[model samples]
Target chain A: MLKAPALEARARAISKELRCLVCQNESIDESNADLAHDLRVLLRQRLMAGDTDQQAIDFIVKRYGDFVLLKPPVEPATYFLWFGPPAVLIVGAVGALLFVRRRNRVRAEPAPLSAQERQRIDVLLREPN
Target chain B: MRRILFIVPIVLFLAVVTYFFVAMRGGYNPSVVPSAMVGKPVPAFDLPGPPSPPNYAGPPVKLGFTNRDMLGRVVVVNFFASWCVPCRVEHPVLMGLGPSANVPVVGIAYKDKGQDAIGFLNEYGNPYVAIALDESGRTGIDFGVYGVPETYVVDKQGIIRLRHVGPLTAESVAREILPVVRALQVQP
Candidate 1:
């Protein structure tokens, strides 16, 4: 553990973003797997060696790739992974808006009655008396 | 136009379903992590050899190997441990690689006891040309090993060409491992 509380906190924050390769879902900070333990130690070693946070993370990413990160970096290859959900949401929202507008337009104006239909309504009203 | 629009959502839903179906049928395993070491030089590691068994008279194959040892020829490196069950299943296939493909197979005892690793080799038949003992698994981490029984194929230049993440089967040996080794061997 770092003697400095600030440095230890910084390390903790960085570790939470790192995925435990063995457990998959858990972060290295939360994982009990031996590999995760080793990674935690390696991360601390890098920090003590005067590596910046990005450098320490990059040291791992160089070996494990972007999958080791809980949040993937925005890049051309991950364009879809990052933007796909919001794009789908926007498309769905637009389609729903268009559907609602069309329905309201249809409801706002009734179709004009034919002459015969008008005469039938008049006859029914006359018989009601 | 309205009818076509009405079918849009259904079409999109089916497209999503078809994608999942195809992926499932293609045997997509979510657990398989792609190795980042491929196409890069093997990580630098100089590991010590596991302790030899008492009164054992096998060839001095227990001498630990290093990255420099990988130079000048094709080599197959396997990460394994006695505690790993799958390693047992893959042991026979590893034994066959040296004879069949004529590539020297190097072994790294990942996080296992020297005695236990020796016992495993004795029972399964030692397939390694040189065995490196990684008791702390620092070398395993350098190699990006998440688990035991991983394998790598290194070319003559000491560049890692391929990494197989799990235990090797006979079929995988023939299809994935042998072809890479063969191609690398013939390269000028």
Candidate 2:
């Protein structure tokens, strides 16, 4: 049997990772919102009542839906929300690299400074000295 | 040319960092109150008043007509539950506001039992003038209360001036709540 304090601590740790369904961004541990508080209290109660960690989470998930999870399951429907950020980052990096390479190629063929421009620069440098 | 290349990457990195910072700071926006509710009229709600003395625990006396009568006053409705640790942290701040501030402070006991609510008030020192029992959470639903310790400041005209979706600290009370109350008091 889990000791009371240990159980409470475990519940709190799990709650910190779980989002409060009512307050989308806030964890059940950090949010003082009613639902979060209730969820926390319920979690503690469940822990004390001998519910396993998975059981406690499953109970909440059953009631509140998957939206309460911060790192939601990567299922067919949520494939986009879960993978979207990293995918975007990869795409952006590749695009940036391609753009830089193209720019480098264009710049590599740079025409030598024109004779007229070089002559003007030489005159300006002499006059300044 | 070298300097431009260096500066471009640095600027891009800074921009990405700043975006994450802002997004993290704002956290999540719950669907309870849309951005439109800001500076809009507060929802009209008339709940039971605080319990009376002898049995009177703290702020909320009893459920009565007078409790509902205070509707037109500039009111601050706070939702709290005994189990919420952050609510305990914010208790003193609410207690201090009762006598000092011009607004009427009311408490809504969200989904808590009467005995527990009374015990919580006795232990923490109630700052609310009246505490309504939202046992069924019906009142909470009406107020768009997504969480406990949320304070809504309503004007005399019953327009909600501000809805703070977290615990009220001294700094927040001064910065957010006070100014709105002062403005509403002066308005009509």
Candidate 3:
């Protein structure tokens, strides 16, 4: 809603990063909720007033929790959120690698010859044909 | 040692399965994300009063609520509106609280027009001791209200002790809200 294109673009960028509290997954820029509109306007105002992006974001987050941020920062609260997936993947890969190595080790081991097998081999070697 | 390694994958698989079962049976609703404001001080906001309700015989509450007003008192702050069906459903339960609980029930009409907000109160006998307006939805956002009829219980020190999302059912009042409030009242 800013008259200046630069201001409008900045507002849009910030809005996209903020989640619409009323909607399930929509960002503020995309949402049509009354709260979202207020947020968009607020963001524009803050930018126009020369607040940095992070400052504006912090102001909003200070009021509404980190929930309003679309991508929450990696903090104590969101450590699991930020790292839970990679940790799972690493664990799974390690387990799989260990399993594969163990299986290959088993396959590489030579089976000891049974007495019957040894006798049959000797008999075959002794036969002319 | 070799045999144990062979059993390791099976053990790990079973462990994962058991975890899933335990977690699923834990019964935590995914939709109800814990409010960030829980245990923290209520957000600071001072809103202007909306127009007085029509056909209501009483004067309006205050200009608005700031975190200061909430200090040194136990308060039940309810976010509601005329358009919200859940708010209507929760009306009788809110009314039921005043006479029995002997507590102040402060209502903030969330994102509603002045006329409609007042009309809703008129339709459902006003249970709130101090009802105000959040016509711009700014105050509701500050409270982290995703929906209407969500109630919060604040302690004497202005710390948010509890938050009840959605409409308050009778079961919720007796089981959850009252116990917390009663405990907080006796609390220093």
Candidate 4:
């Protein structure tokens, strides 16, 4: 067993990032399933072998797909998952803002007087009625 | 324009809800993860142990499969165990593979005790050319087998073409597995 505190802490951090495939909703660190245990052991072995954190993660990701990672890497396949909600929110907010601003601008602006209307106003002013 | 904007959020919400409702109709098994090994060559390692006699019986050809065993033919590799209920459910469908379907099904009994495997096969007929015992689950990890009752369809060139998770039902067999096998066998 790897008893080094630093290694143990790093292993824990890595395990938490991995999803236990048998228990879909839980992380490998928290799962008691055999597959999860196997994964946890593999992660620890990699860490103790002086592999960097990303290297350790890459091993797991290669074995399993991005689905095994709780937070999958942002790629063409998953672009929508990562940026989609924020993109929609920003687009909707900007659209609504533009709409509201245009409406308000229309309400605030005074109507331009036509030539005939100006002439009628002048006549009314002259007659003082 | 402003009225349209006012309805946008509701419209989006309805679309999202409709997607989920339609998706749920296919049924759900959250534990399944798409196998990464699909499209890749068969994992290199000799499957340990030999197929059990009488119950876990099939063609008398081989005891266990190696990387070389998969060449020159389309085959199905089934990961199963006695403990898994779903494996039992799918066993009958698998039994038809060898004699009826003319497709060799390689079995790997994952993390199962040997005698229990024999007992399981004795109770439920086995449809495997050979049943290899993956005692340590290293082979399972190599094959990306996270759950039991997962099946892989390999092409003649030893490339994995399709992965089916969970039990093989008659519906899934006809709809998913059979069509893929038929297509792969033709031409290339």
Among all candidates shown, the one with the greatest DockQ = 1
Give lDDT tens digits, candidate 1, residues B1-188.
87998899899899999999999898778898888889999999998887774234455584777899889999999999999999998988998998899899989999998888888888878888888889999888888899988999999999999999888999999999999999999996
Distance from true location, Cα of A86 in model 1, Å? 0.7
Off by over 4 Å in 3: A94-129, B1-27, B53-67
Q: Give per-residue CA lDDT, model 2, range B88-179, as digits (tens).
A: 98999998886778566877787777667778887877676666777766556445566677788877777667788778899989988888
- Residue B78 in model 4: shift from native, Å? 0.8
TM-score of 2: 0.54
Off by over 4 Å in 1: A112-129, B53-59
Per-candidate TM-scores read 0.91, 0.54, 0.81, 0.83
Candidate 4: segments with Cα more than 4 A from true spot: A92-129, B26-31, B50-52, B55-58
DockQ of each: 0.75, 0.08, 0.47, 0.61
- Candidate topping TM-score: 1
Task: Please give, as one word, the docking class of candidate 4.
Answer: medium
Q: Comparing chain B with the reference, what is the TM-score for each candidate?
A: 0.91, 0.75, 0.84, 0.88
Q: Write the per-residue lDDT of candidate 2 for residues A88-112, one digit (tens) a residue.
A: 8998899799889999999899878
Whole-model lDDT per candidate: 0.90, 0.72, 0.83, 0.83
Q: How displaced is residue B181 in candidate 2, in Å?
A: 1.6
CAPRI-style class, candidate 2: incorrect
| Candidate 4 local lDDT, A60-92, one digit each (tens) | 787688898999888999999999999989998
TM-score of chain A of 2: 0.71
